[model samples]
Target: MDGGVLEDEVNRARLVHAAGLVAPDDAQLAGALSASDDAIAEAGRQRRILAATLGNAVNVLNPSMIVLGGFLGSLRDVDRDAFDDEVRARALAASAENLELASAALGADRLLIGAADAAMQRLLADPLG
Candidate 1:
């Protein structure tokens, strides 16, 4: 999954949450980031919610490998563990076989790196090679 969440502060103590899914072709994952305390808290809350949603989605997909990318892709172990647990909870037993969950290899630059890598790979695979 590729996306980003940004929180915004509407007032001194109030905040607004804005986030969305990002497509591979999207140039930027721009959004609002809250400075307010509540907004910050809301961002955290939304992060967890997103983690759970991702876990559930992965469970549903049950792919052999699951790669998490985006702003929060580099979350700490605890956060990653929480996401994994949620994914497992929602996934079926058979689907969990050899499941690999890890941070995105490209970190925050995955999209750019992936594009370059693809280009290089294609170039290498060309008949001209």
Candidate 2:
């Protein structure tokens, strides 16, 4: 839920159903990314949200790359181009110029890797360990 585009699919389906354009709990919702205009629009909106959030971070942190992990890593399947464009537009021009947006190479193992990293840091800090 904390991941940006990761939690958007459910909301997209809900909005589509609420508009009466689709049936709730229907199979069509599974394919909404490809078949529904509303779903695509929702994805765009979510991507914009992600872009804005990242842009703000870029302004403060100036990170050279932003790796989208978890569900957001799958954004390439939904709207990678739009998301990239939005980030470029919203971020500071200098920060955005050489910025790289990439999917987490660890895939589902990102959390595991993070935990391992924390454990390593703790072990290194504890002299008696």
Candidate 3:
């Protein structure tokens, strides 16, 4: 539960299959490097994990849509479908109906961009706006 340990875990997860070092201070560049270096395979792995996990969830609750963000969106079609199939096979039959998965329309910075949008929305909704 130490802060350093938690941060290390985060970094390790981020860079588990990374081809190079990825540090917190260099996360932005690391994100880019990740996208350029192993985005496809990594994304496929993630998708497969998600699919299998969701498929195995008790009672089944497959997401109607899956939005691949971060470095994952850049993956090619073949990898995408493979991941989709992995998830579909595990997903509940009814839950898998009409399921859709696609890369984020925004690029690598979608998370940051989304945070900005959320902040702006929260501010605009505030009485001070």
Candidate 4:
């Protein structure tokens, strides 16, 4: 509700009341992995979101493989099985069949590489401009 915005005091208060956190940092969120049921539920929510997004992508792009980069790629380190299961369940059989999901192999350099690649693509598409 309210677009999940935490801008207002009421929303932030509600989030704090519900999750017992006021803007948890990455380390805090990561620590939650083994600390509480809420974290598990949040992880599940993330998996579902990923599943839906990837499912749509599969239907549209029909990519044989998908590389999860950036923060998304880090899910492999958190709970690979759950992520895989969610994707398998949500994506169409034809779309998911033979689909491969791999974490970015570029490690910390992925963001830089991705940015450079995007820039190159844009340049190539308008070489004269």
In terms of lDDT, the best-performing candidate is 2
Q: How well is each residue in 1-129 modelled by candidate 1, as lDDT tens digits?
A: 236432321121222223233342212221323334543465456556655665566667768877755544433232567667656666676776567777666655776788999999989889597
Q: What does candidate 3's lDDT look like per residue over 18-37, in tens digits?
A: 53444432334334434645
Number of backbone collisions per candidate: 2, 0, 2, 0
Ranking of models by lDDT: 2, 4, 3, 1
Question: What TM-score does candidate 1 reach?
Answer: 0.52
Whole-model Cα lDDT of every candidate shown, in order: 0.52, 0.65, 0.54, 0.62
Clash pairs, candidate 1, are 7-33, 7-34
Model 1: per-residue Cα lDDT at residue 11: 20
Query: Model 1: how far is 109 from its true place, Å?
Result: 3.6
- Candidate 2: residue 56 lDDT (0-100): 83
- Per-candidate TM-scores read 0.52, 0.59, 0.56, 0.57
The sequence of per-residue lDDT tens digits that candidate 2 reaches over residues 48-95 is 666777788888888898887644555434667767777778889998
Model 1 lDDT vs. the true structure?
0.52
* Candidate 2 stretches greater than 4 Å from native: 1-39, 124-128
RMSD of each: 8.5, 6.8, 6.4, 6.4
Which lDDT value does model 1 have at 111?
A: 69
